[model samples]
Target: MATKSNSTKTSSSKKGKMNLKDIPFSKERLIELFRQMLLGRRFEEKCGQQYQMKKFSGFCHLYIGQEAVAVGSIAALEIGKDYVFTTYRDHVHALILGISAKEVMAELFMKRTGSSHGKGGSMHFYNGKTRFMGGNGIVGGHTPLATGAAFASKYRGDGAVALCYMGDAAVNQGTFHESLNMAGLWGLPIVYIVENNIYGMGTSTERSCAQPELWKRTGDAYNIPGRQVNGMDMLEVYEATRQAVEDARNGQPVFLEMLCYRYRGHSMSDPATTYRTKDEVGQWRMKDPIERLKEQFPTVFTESMVKDMEEEIKQEVADSIKFAEDSELPELSDIWTDVCVDYPGYPGREASDNKYEFPYEQLENAKK
Candidate 1:
């Protein structure tokens, strides 16, 4: 059994300190950990810089500080069997699911070679091969779709799972409750992840949710089990997700509400500094999931570990831009090529009739 770790805060007013003594900690794993967070953070940072330069445009929600939720949760899933679905803050999630940074960047650049054929941009991302279910721009709309996917897994007896994630504010929507009730009743093979980032747009969670224990949003309505976990610590997020995954595999759909905070605004347009105090951001910065882990592991680690990570990630980010820029855009005919399939005047067409592709554009608009 993995030893349970409880986080402790630096201040007495804080909850608990960060600890990861139980899990097998290794330099390689830690390096990979740093890589994931660094990649996500650097990618988001680059997107912002690019947006300013007009190299990339259109709705971009940077996931600068929320890397832990994507990386840790992804570590718990078996790719090709599990599905990744989330709200508009989705680039990191898609990347963690193995979407190439180059393709993601190309999409951001609106080049036809990128994911969604350059349709998704920064907020909407998807890759069928990676089992990434794409990002939903709607507030709480994807909840039902994820639930339906989970229900499909069970219906097919595929031993698969679906992870549905949403913001703390999305809980206020009617679909959130409707899906929770459905999942609870049917015992779907899904893990409900409530990313309680403390605020929804300009509104704080406290002001937005009358009961800020937003994880318990549907506690009274359904008997589905749920728990609150610290979202800032990667290992803590990994462990909780592991437990929830196992339970869901064993016929119990678990709801995990990770108490997280975004260091940036809701999107590129919204100014996060307005609602959140710098002191609050500073406190959370000290408890950075990557920094906290570096402090915990190798017993006697040095400064080089952090510096080397930065250097390596910087080069990697540079290479990613090169790759995306070098990648060729889709041919003009590709627009209609992927549109619809013909009868082909061949047999077995009836056997392939069950396939369906998401109408990404229409869905994105309807969501807002």
Candidate 2:
């Protein structure tokens, strides 16, 4: 068993004690992390604008304030060799995994060029080749799926780890417990990340959970190593995830609770201000992940460079929108095409003529 690491906090609050030189990442890597976080924020901002303009038909969840949690955590993974999963707020995860902004935008616009061929909307963006398992709609539903992936990796000795991202509220679901039990028992290489943004759709964690410190609660339950990091601080998130990933790859299950916040509402439909105060939101804005990173390395990210990066990101976002708009929608007949296949002597549903009724309905005395 891997020795459990102590709960850690490496946020900006310790700025006086820790300087930029104290951090381990290289200048280039730090810049890349900032770019990734900025890109996710920009992409989601575009998504929110499109949702308001009715360019997309389904639900949209913006990962505005939680960029660090996705970018920092994913940076630790060996892409293509490892796997990733998340809930509906998954645009950031997909973008971080090397999926083009155009592919995700096209998916939102229901264009045939989308990752899911425009079939799976915002919530169901998938790319099996990239190993990003995509998002799920149900609360805590994907937990088991991630655990199963870890099981397969261990069985095949693939040396792969599964990174599962879930919200704070999802920890209460039964699948969370069941999956953790199985992972702990089998020593599967999986890490359960709870993006604890405090509010589970307007209700604060204190009101909903008995123990608000989720890192401790879930960790103690399954005896899996866990850590709580300031999600708003990208460096802290990166460091914590690096350790967790190391433990997981060595056949030890891990849990992580990212103490973060979301600037927007649960979904595009919600206003997000009725339950929380504007002052509270303002406080978090002061700790914006992008700004915090820039502050830590002022020399690396000068004002002029920051401005240039902003302009570059804006142009990239514009191009993605244009690409999605120019793309065509899926043909009506294509609807069930990618779903499955039919074979000789084992025809698919449409190819079969047999009809059947329920066993209870087949009884002569049963009511229609």
Candidate 3:
């Protein structure tokens, strides 16, 4: 097991000390991390704007303040070789994992060019080539799927590791426990990350969980080593993930609780203010991940460099919106496509002789 760092601060009160010399990444890599976080921040901000303009429908959860949790941890992994699974608040993760911004935005617009081909909107972005498993909707549902991915890697003797991300609320679900038990028992190469932003929907962790110190939740039961890191600090998230990934590759499963916060509501329909105070939100915002990175490395992230990056990101996001707007929606025939894999000797291997019909049309005819 990787030794825990005494310097890892769980709360925003201390704003843990970050030494530039301690960061394993080069200066250029540090700048790249900043850019990734900035891109995520800008992209999510645009998503909120588009949602308000009614450009897309359905539940839209923003990873507004939690940019570091995705950017930092992903930076530690070998992208195409390793696998990643995240919850519905997943646009940022998709972007960081090399899913083109245009494809992700198009997915949000429900266009045919989406990662999931307009069928799996908002909470279902997928990229098989990159091995980004999915943007799963159910609270704790994807845990088992991630465990299976780790099992596959171990079965194949592949050195790849699987990283599963979830919210604080998901810890209470039975699947979370079941999946971890399997991983621990089988020594699967996986890392279970809980983005404990203190709230599960409108309910705070104190109310929803009997023990809110989430990092400690998995260790005793599963024999998996668990650690809490300042998710707001990208470097800390990266370092911890790097060690955990090493351990996972050696057939040891680990649990990480990223102490972070989301600036947006649970979904687009939620106002978020009903449950939390403006003062509390402000405090977390002061410890914003993007700003914290800038403060930690002023020499690397100069004002001009940051301004240039922001402008470039701004245009990139704008182009993505244009691409989504110009792209066509999925063809009506697409409804029957990609639903299931077909193979020889399968029950429905032959094409249907009957013409395809829309289900809603049938319902309308029945009403008549």
Candidate 4:
């Protein structure tokens, strides 16, 4: 399945004056993109608030400054047909990939109404209907799963592509390299995107990765073509991902390094000020993805329209919080469900029958 190498290209600059008619997307489509990014931003903000209030108990990673990477890349794929796999910093990706804000929030809340039915909390959101594989917790762990998905697509001859997203740190993981090797060898239809936000959990990429230039990391070893895109600019992300998706669909595996930023700390626990300076953070904020999009097309995004969108997103976030609050927690029996296929002697089957015989005597004894 080895395919010919495709040349890596950078995103075209949208500098100088550009008319509304000259924009690639239609007016309604651009507005939709803006709304999605805004929704992601607002939803994550509410998540931060809830985590601080002790609404959920787990490691919570917020996607504050990296909206464009998820929204723009996903906007290029055929949703429900192509598959998506993201890292633990996954709320925004889940929302962008068609998992409802309500379901995602419910997952964060650890309620049964969550995408994972409460079993998988904030870091493992899954929805088969939307082809969202999961919000995997282990760094670079899900890359192989995404690769396998692409292999399946190739085996079935389905023109579907797998978009695997990871943090800058995950690129150094052994699984990341292994997955890329297999994808490159098999010519799988997969796009590996590294959201190079400059840090891998407080350790800056420069201090961590031997080659901080992540896009250049793939070509020599795996024969995979890589491109770096301005992840702060939504249009640039979309355009770059669109081309990558096209190449991937043709059995040409591609790699994209999105130059984005995460305003929040690695997780809820870190204040993010100890390592990076406030001035550095402020500089990145100046190039916020949402603001960049609006500035690029001022004629398209009117002040009133932007206000209405913000208000609408505010209500939506409120509704999601309410939905999460009202949802029920998973039952004790749910622990055994969704674990294995039904068989005559399987633990889940026996548990379902109330036999409750298992190696973990504590749980079985408790049932008795």
Candidate 3 overall Cα lDDT vs. reference?
A: 0.88
> Model 1, 22-45: lDDT tens per residue?
564565665676688878988889
**lDDT of each structure?**
0.77, 0.85, 0.88, 0.88
Off by over 4 Å in 3: 1-20, 343-368
Task: Point out the higher-scoring one by lDDT: 1 or 3.
Answer: 3
Off by over 4 Å in 1: 1-21, 24-27, 298-301, 328-334, 342-368
**What C-alpha lDDT, on a 0 to 100 scale, does residue 124 get in candidate 3?**
90
Worst 10-residue lDDT window for candidate 3 reads 5-14
TM values, all candidates = 0.84, 0.90, 0.90, 0.91
Q: Over 4 Å off in model 2, which ranges?
A: 1-21, 343-368
Give candidate 4's TM-score. Answer: 0.91
What local lDDT does model 3 show for residue 281? Answer: 91
Tens digits of lDDT, candidate 4, 192-311 = 999999988889999998888888888767878888898988888988889899989998899999999999899999998878999999999988988888887887787998998999
For candidate 3, write residues 1-368 as lDDT tens digits: 43432223344323544566877878888888888899999999999999999999999999999999999999999988999999999999999887899999999999999888899888998888879998999999999999999999999998999999999999999999999999988999999999999998999999999988888877767878888888988877887899889989988898999999999898999988889999989999999998888887777777998999999999999999999999999987676676667522333433553453347888989999
Instruction: Arrange candidates, best TM-score first.
Output: 4, 3, 2, 1
